[model samples]
Target: MNRSQYLCLTALAAAIGFASAHAADTTVSADVTAKINTRTMQKTTQFDRFIITYRNGTTERSSATAATQNVTAAVSRAKLHASANATAGSALGVTWKRKLAIGSDLVRTSRKLDRNEALTLMQQIATDPAVAAVEPDVMLHAVKDYVAPASASPGGSAPNDTNFPLQWHMRPGNGTVEKVGRDTTSFANWGGSGASSAWPNYDGSGVTVAVIDTGVIIHGDLNEDYAGAGYDMINDSFVSGRAADGRSPGGWDLGDWTNTEPYITECLDGNASAGEASSWHGSHVFGNIAAVNNNGTGVDGIATHAKVIPIRALGHCGGYTSDIADSITWASGGHVDGIPDNPNPAQVISMSLGGDGTCLASDVSGTAIAGAMARGATVVVAAGNDSEDASSHTPASCPGVVAVASVGITGKRAFYSNYGSTVTVAAPGGGIYANDASSGTQVDAGFVWSTVSSSTTTPDQGTSVTGGMAGTSQATPHVSGIVALMIEAVNEAGHATLTPDQIRLALVNSARNFPNTPDHPIGAGIVDANAAISAAINYNSVAPSIALTSGVAAIASGKAGDAILYRIDVPTGATNLTLRTLGGTGDVSLFAKRGNPPSNDGGNADFKSVKPGNSESIVQTTVSPGSWYVLVVGVKDFANVQVLANYTAH
Candidate 1:
């Protein structure tokens, strides 16, 4: 395997970080530490960055100084090298090597190797002239992988369509007008001037969405309109199997959303809490994405025109990994062997809640998420309510899912929102607790203005008692709703069905870049639903052009500002062209100029810090049908590099 790919595999073992304060920290302690100290790994964080220790007395540290000219780039290279070297070294050192991941480091060692031998090897490596310093390879507590129960039935037919529309597309047929409440921050400021004018047609009709969260209580806004029958993944059975009517519970659950059993009025908050507060959290989230707009009551929804397939997952401190994984797979109509297919399959799944943990791409949760995507489902998740960046939680951190951050009404980031380049976009998740205007707008209230559950009928229950709330949890559904709207527009416009990659491109390309905010906070600006829907309807169906450059140029892997130039002909009035890469971090860039190539010397390049996946566009001004030179540059927080230098005419 290539060096990076090798690093990726090694890193997979350490995919998850600390799950909770109560979880186990490591599996093998004394021997692991002894081995790490024996083999010298990099000492300083600046020079070493990452260190890997194996059971068979092998150690590896990233050579931060030996990589590319960029210091940061070198560190990244060193970390990868450390992992690769450690694994290969362990393979050569012992009869059987086992891989272990501690936080971000991947350590490999022989299962049979004794602690004394490990210590000796470590000491030798530490003293070596090439060695820097070494430290104990710590162990991390994470969820163990759960084995799927054997399927009761044989394999069924795989889905035929590769691109399934987001579920909110089915809302229009539900018969309700769009809701326009007091708050208008999310829809506004998405684009340069305002929201796009694309919501009039195909307002999410016939599409089915799955929302996995706290149980939802049946409410007027939902049962009256926009609600489709759903399943209870936590109960480990179909909706019919779990409910008296064979239908998933719609509103408020005194019982935990994680466990399928009945409510136990025990040691919870009080009489009020069964396990966790079964408030209308999920109901509000569902409404925001597909509440009937112009319903003449309550707030407006992003897509007042779609149907939803609700699946509950939260409860009792937190839910179990096994249940969450099963729900994710089942929601996508995946073959779990024993479980019946979800009565209503969802094309789009939105996870508005998350925990503080670092999970790898191979974790059980990650695997399930990937499986759902493989089945052509669009997974959208909140980065987390926690304010830390890399510390952001999983399901969102999973490779295939689109991780969302939170923004507020004023076009700024929410204080409780997590920020990272890995995040895709920022939606209106509201700000921190109420303080004042000096502390930024208290958007938490205004952010979550949508339909709520009516399960609580007492004075403290129902809409009067349990009202809509806000958080990254609430912001996620807005994007989900918009995704549904865009899918509908795409179908109505008669453009070719878009793949997840294409849908992602449309969202990023059309997103509003928040130049004034921190790059980590807002991501590729806010998700412009209106603009996204418009692009979906009028998508550029042609394949992106790829042509290599004639001369040498630097192509940095992570940087977002570097440009690679190539000559190509431009069609008359061509507005933009897309640049794509097959490997690496899936980064992209855009460039624009007025005239034809050789003639048009004045041009500009816009570097996107994070990889926007398979394809992205360089929106250009009007140009004559003639030859031109276009440059696609790679950029990041540090340097500029080139990937492929090619030009294509739209």
Candidate 2:
């Protein structure tokens, strides 16, 4: 609503320019052009860097020298061009920077290139038989609400448990002027994520979560392990704000205050006043997830007993996608060259950062995410602070991530939350004013209060608690901490940790429905920690029974992300049984098996059917008499859909 929230969209673009090229060299294919434009959001006109993924076993993937040679050849072949302000080479002095951890090459031009020119060059690169994909090396930043410097005053520097009363995002409590001074809003039922309810029950023991952001600094409220506590993965020394050049071991925030010359001058896209205060953003996010509880100081984290491995991905002027990808890969126990192996890999990777554009399958970040998921680490990301469809954001739209949206204390979508079907669930991200207010006026307690720094430019000597921050950044860690609890609850009981897919489904299935209809669809509803923990514990529980050609033949209702299970008993001499779902205007996936429930992974199931709409069928020609389990997961919301099983006995 304010100028700060638009920082991700309008403020990130810097000075623009154009290029001179033949009309024939102006574009790639139409489809590719459209995607490139979408990623840029037309907000950014300058592009000088690119991330190129080459197929495995290819020469480019194996040899960095070979990769650079390929890009140079592409520039020459495509009549390489730069932005209006840049024209310094065969292609703006195209130079290969480094190879990414995911086996992708990071190439930089001498200067910026306009969108079309960048697209034309990328198209040329893709034309290589070994090239898998290539695109701009996009920048992703922390997603906290942008507060104007004048309004962002440091709150009480109290190092005790005083500010816990104002943490409405953690538990249920109506906001009133009497309780929180100068806040004129009341919602009798302020149903929060049930995190506190599960506190006395589960404390997320023996689980490590990777907090990938600006890096968690020294704080009294936060507990970080010495070994594998994460790293400073930022590649550029200028963006990192660290005196040393190479990424070091400590994932500490040396301060990313971007009001200086190069930072201010470069960050001037649409934002005239782009002087942002150093947030200590990573520490804030870390506090929300796993800050020590009952420590007689500050606030309580959702997963009180969980440990955080803060992976520093963003600093100064946001961060590069390649750095974030490397952090993700290393955090989840994957390999990243030039960086030591993480001794303590996390069970969940909490990312409160992202940038414009939906994730392409070949995106380096998306590929890293898939790798993390394959390692059984649950990845959670913020939907974004830009109040647009989350489908337009990275990580959020990426497959295998539990994308979270923001809800206010009243259980409505936050004014700045990005929404859409991509969001996996919602959590309290705080609204400084009433939900109807486009932009918040003035209310300190209405924000998501947590551990923050007092100094605007550098470390404030010690920590402070400020009730002056809110966004999908706050919402994401709540879910991550809960996931930690879920993992702990299951693992502490001597059970193997749930797979990332199963964990995602359990979170989706256990969510309590939204109290009010959202303007756009946002997963199941506000996340319920109590319900989700129970759901994880009972994930493999026996399925409810239904009769095939005997009694109740149909189930008529479902919501997206709901994987409802039922079983049917066939009789002796049974010839065949046909199970199908129809009469619905929403997407649904059907899976069935005789003895065990089938996985709805599109494969790995005994028999499955996944078409477009609710019309899906699984026909077993040769059937045996037994309890046959069926799993019906809503790919989209369904109203009066009927899931029925028919049989042929001869």
| Number of the top-ranking candidate, with lDDT as the measure | 2
Prediction 2 global C-alpha lDDT: 0.72
Model 1: lowest-lDDT 10 consecutive positions: 1-10
The TM-score obtained by model 2 is: 0.79
Clashes of each: 54, 6
Candidate 1 runs further than 4 Å off: 1-198, 223-228, 236-276, 432-446, 454-466, 541-650
TM-score for each model: 0.54, 0.79
What is the per-residue lDDT of model 2 for residues 84-197, given as tens digits with 9 covering 90 to 100?
544454354678788877788899887777665675677678767688777677677788564423344445444566666667677742333224434555443353777877
The most accurate candidate by TM-score is: 2
Q: Candidate 2: misplaced stretches above 4 Å? A: 1-3, 9-23, 26-41, 81-91, 146-160, 173-178, 181-186, 226-228, 269-272, 435-441, 460-463, 541-650
